[model samples]
Target: MRALVLAILAALAVTGHSATVKAVHAEEREGFKVIVHPDNPARELERGFLRSAFLKKSTEWHGETVRPIDLATRFTVRDRFTTDVIGKTRAQLRSYWNQQIFSGKGVPPPEGESAAAVIAYVLAHRGAVGYLPASVDPGKARVVPVR
Candidate 1:
């Protein structure tokens, strides 16, 4: 049984499944949730998909342009989201965005001033998604399960 478990872990590490697992575990530890517009049909998301979306690599969802939102300034949940979901430290993410911008490749996502603003952005934009601490009220935004 131990050998089998180890084999499975090895396979996951080689295939990058372990990173997704880590993302899930990280969010659980961070106590944050991912939210989407109420109109979006996605009830769950893979952590990698979210990382791609936030990095602006995946720009559409369900025929709508994906609108990945973020907090305007540093916040605990923002830090957690970047680390757990985006897989980058805040400074790393900023440097990434800086490189993208310098090359005229992309820009960071729209940001909200507060949790309420984030919820409002999601509620107002059909393809929008954001993350907030679990303690925050999500208003009409639909909380999506993340793996």
Candidate 2:
């Protein structure tokens, strides 16, 4: 029985059916600088700024009178990866933040439906900042870089 088990295990390993996993690299995209409407009078973020700016400052919303938002849409890269980094699902992100808002802990950022919508909101409001896929062309709105 022991011999048979070892033989099966070896066969599975050779056939790529073993539990051994392979690592895949994430596709890296060029980063951008995040900017706001010129008329808004808020400062712009340099390249690679949003990650720290958005996640670090709890008082950020109070400063701008608007909360920070992220790309948590179902198909967005940030949406999928954030949960793995923070141990929470997207639904949990909304639910947990909603609970906080109810308890006056902190306000949650607005949820966007798509990248374009997120970008539009950020451009229109001085308080918003978000990332876009590298493929997107940077128009008048400020672009922010990502890893």
Candidate 3:
């Protein structure tokens, strides 16, 4: 039985499946739920969803709207944060969004540029949400795990 378990573990490692399954935990940010617009069909997201969508899969966000936050700023806000969490740096995200916008493939979310702008935009638009330093105002929106 021990040998069988070891073989299974070895196979999982060799297949690289274990690496893809890394778990993401829920974390608190400023205050809001970090949510999609209530009208959006997306009900819930996993914590790693952003990383998977933007970084790994490069999935175009096609809901009511979406926004990208800076990796460095997010990292400064919390130790648990990662570029992989939001999927890319500010420049990389901007490049991709611009491509989508120009191609008419999709409408990119407005750029917050800074954490404060993110707070303001999210507060004003129920359909928009993005991450900000925990130090910023939380009342602007909700904080939901990206996944």
Candidate 4:
């Protein structure tokens, strides 16, 4: 029985089915910068409020419409933001948006093709909020700490 169990474990490892494998990629856990238009007025945000803003629950900030922007789903920074900030996986967010659309509630944030695009949009719009890799320079946008 001991030999059989050992062999089964070996097989599972060789097949890449180990249950102990970590799901998060190293790059995907790296920090992200949450940026808003410099004129947005808000300086900081709680994690819950940031998540709600991203999820489209809190639609306004200081009387101005809150426009949230997302990086493309395949971006590593976006994965980190979704996991650490929004508290959802990409697939889960997609499903949630689908449900919202079918219910006539709302749609997910518009996706930026790249970090530069996001930065540009935020800088150009008064209510824009978005995320980028921590390494990126935010240009004219204000970086908001997510606590």
The candidate scoring highest on TM-score is: 4
Per-residue lDDT tens digits of candidate 2, residues 1-147?
A: 999999999988786752332211231123323434334454544322443345433345425744455655554455433443334555776687677779876665565676677777777877666555556654666653333
lDDT per residue for candidate 3 within 57-88, as digits (tens), equals: 44445533344433233343322344335545
Q: TM-score, each model?
A: 0.78, 0.49, 0.41, 0.81
Residue range with the least summed lDDT across 10 consecutive positions in model 2: 20-29
lDDT of 4: 0.86
Q: Candidate 1 residues 5-115, lDDT tens each?
A: 999999888889867667656544657889999889997999999999999999799988999999875565677788888898778999999999999999999888898
Error of 1 at 130 (Å): 0.6
* Decreasing lDDT order of the candidates: 1, 4, 2, 3
RMSD to truth, every model: 10.4, 7.7, 10.8, 4.7
Ranking by TM-score: 4, 1, 2, 3
The per-candidate count of clashes, in order, stands at 0, 8, 12, 0
Runs in model 1 with CA error above 4 Å? Answer: 1-30
TM-score of 1: 0.78
Candidate 4 structure, TM-score to reference: 0.81
What candidate 4 gets wrong by more than 4 Å, as runs, is 1-23
User: If both were scored by TM-score, which would come out higher, candidate 1 or candidate 2?
Assistant: 1
Task: Say what the RMSD of model 3 is.
Answer: 10.8
Clash-forming residue pairs, model 1: none
**Tens digits of per-residue lDDT for model 4, 1-147:** 999999999988886853324545665667898999887778788889889988999978888788889999768778789889889887898899999999999989999999999999898788889999998999888998978
